[model samples]
Target: MFIKGVKILFVVLLFYLMTSTSTTPLEAYEETSPARRLHKAHALCTLNKSPPATDDNDNEQIVETFIRCMATKMGLWTDKDGYNAKQVAKFFNKHNYENEVMTIVDYCNHQHQQTNLDLWAYESYRCATEGRIGAWLEEYYMLSLKL
Candidate 1:
């Protein structure tokens, strides 16, 4: 009889342990979801400037859109119009910038620490506009990797 009582108590304790292991409300509230962070970043970006005027032949607008899309592809923005890595690679291939794009992808993917998304977005835009992405890719990789 005592052994059976112990077994029942053990089962009750186990059940209590399992059921009470859920996160506290404070913990749940403190942790921001990745999707929410992405949305906030996108909102901040949009609030910083007016939308660029659209023109089919406007090279500057085209490049700006491409950079912003790249930021989204890097998981830094919530914009629906952004390209993924594969699409960005295709774009680079079409523009004959495939090698530079490859370098950028490798650097961004393999860095030891997280890159500052805002700084990266800004630097990428600068490099894209200056037609010096290859150099910027190398520099960014070195700086980010501390190598």
Candidate 2:
């Protein structure tokens, strides 16, 4: 009887923790102190080492690679062309920001389709970073107040 009661209590506590909006201080710290966003850009672009190919497609490909790398780092992308729903949900859950942000990606693919590759790449990075930072800042501020 005691063992069963203990198991039930554990389940209840786990559910509460998973469903709670409040994040621990360590989680806030990890979210606020984001890793360098452009680490992949320099290694992939290597513009100083050699000029990129003259073809527009080649230049665009470089931009695509950079954008993809950034998205992957943010857990918004997968090895395949698009994002995996399960993985994205897991990311948002782990980060504890499902209630704060709306769209899965900050910018939609259709809106940038007509733009120049450079602009598209910049917008992608900008939007993702802004959304993440905004959420992190809010969570960090709230947690700090609690502390």
Best by TM-score: 2
Looking at model 2, the pairs that clash are: none
- In model 2, what lDDT does residue 9 have? 31
For all candidates in order, the CA lDDT equals 0.41, 0.42
Question: What would the per-residue lDDT of candidate 1 be over residues 84-136, giving only the tens digit for each residue?
Answer: 34444553353577666756654454331224443344334343323354444
Q: For each candidate, give its TM-score against the true structure.
A: 0.28, 0.32
What does each candidate score in C-alpha RMSD?
A: 23.1, 18.0
lDDT per residue as tens, model 2, 1-147: 344334333432332333243354333444423222223323333333335658655654544555455445555554533433344444446576654443544233334433354445434433443456445544644554564
- How much is the lDDT of residue 68 in candidate 2? 53
